[model samples]
Target: MGWLVGVVAVVALLGFYLTFTAKRVDRLHARAASAGRALDAQLVRRAATSAVLAEEHGEPDLYAAARGALDARVEDREAAENDLTRLLRKQELDSSEASDVAVIAASRRVALARQVHTDFVRDALAVRSRPLVRALRMTRRHGAPAYFDIDDPTLPSVTQVTSRATRD
Candidate 1:
């Protein structure tokens, strides 16, 4: 009777462990999805703000090109965004309201949001790739998660230093 009770206890403990792991994997996947959406929103904000700045302060050609790219379809969005970046790099625009503070803040938000999304994706991937999860087909229901990649400018070193100093 003692041996039988021990066996039953071990089985119950194993079952609980498996259930907990499965729930954790599901939570991670959900977190990754949420982060991805946030990143997408930030990206859109960056592009729209850039377009506005380009129109207000950039040359006419730059404004036209940027406006077109901002309105581009989803299939061509990546390339259009890359082109917008290149155009901005080629010109020195006047500091209108659009470019003075708004664009700078938008760019910074995009960089931070991208980093957050990437971290969440890594967490989900780590959980989904675990040996037990893989063997048990635990993540098969949700399919695979993907990482978002985009080219955006980093915040200036001066801005970074000032922010750190203020925090301290």
Candidate 2:
């Protein structure tokens, strides 16, 4: 009987230990998934700035080119996330380690995307503030055509006509 009692106690202790460990594993897994989603959200938000904000600056060509590049980088980041998730699952990595790797990968892309967008914005702003823009605006306000050769395609048809008259 004593031997049986001892066996029962050991079994109960083992059950409790297993339950505790399983709960801990579950918590960690939840944290990893949540962290992955958070990182993805940050990446998405940063990716949008170049498209939405830059378009307002009257830079269609620059906006189109940058938007394309940003879209590609964002897709690459998403694929990286998917690959990391697959790696973690296949390797049966610890939940904490899986979350850490995902966070790091997302962060690297976020930093790069933000840096590129920031540089583009800075250049656009610098160009907006140049003397040429101000001078041209002043000329238009004074009812004088901007001081440019008529062959520039951006010039209006009426302005181009004036240029044609001068040449003829």
Best by TM-score: 1
> Could you give candidate 1's per-residue lDDT for residues 111-152 as a string of tens digits?
788888889899889988889999998898775777766676
Q: What's model 1's lDDT at 123?
A: 89
Q: Record all residue pairs in model 2 with backbone atoms less than 3 Å apart, i.e. clashing.
A: none
lDDT string for model 2 (56-158, tens) is 4454643453344445563355443333233322222122343333433444555554444444444433443557545544223222111111111110111
Q: What are the runs in model 2 whose C-alpha is more than 4 Å off?
A: 57-75, 78-168
Residue pairs clashing, model 1: none
Supply the TM-score for candidate 1: 0.77
Candidate 2 displacement at residue 36 in angstroms: 0.7
Give the C-alpha miss distance for residue 45 in model 1, angstroms: 0.7
> CA lDDT, every prediction?
0.73, 0.41
**Cα RMSD to the true fold for all candidates:** 6.6, 29.1
Reference-based TM-score of each model: 0.77, 0.37
Clashes of each: 0, 0
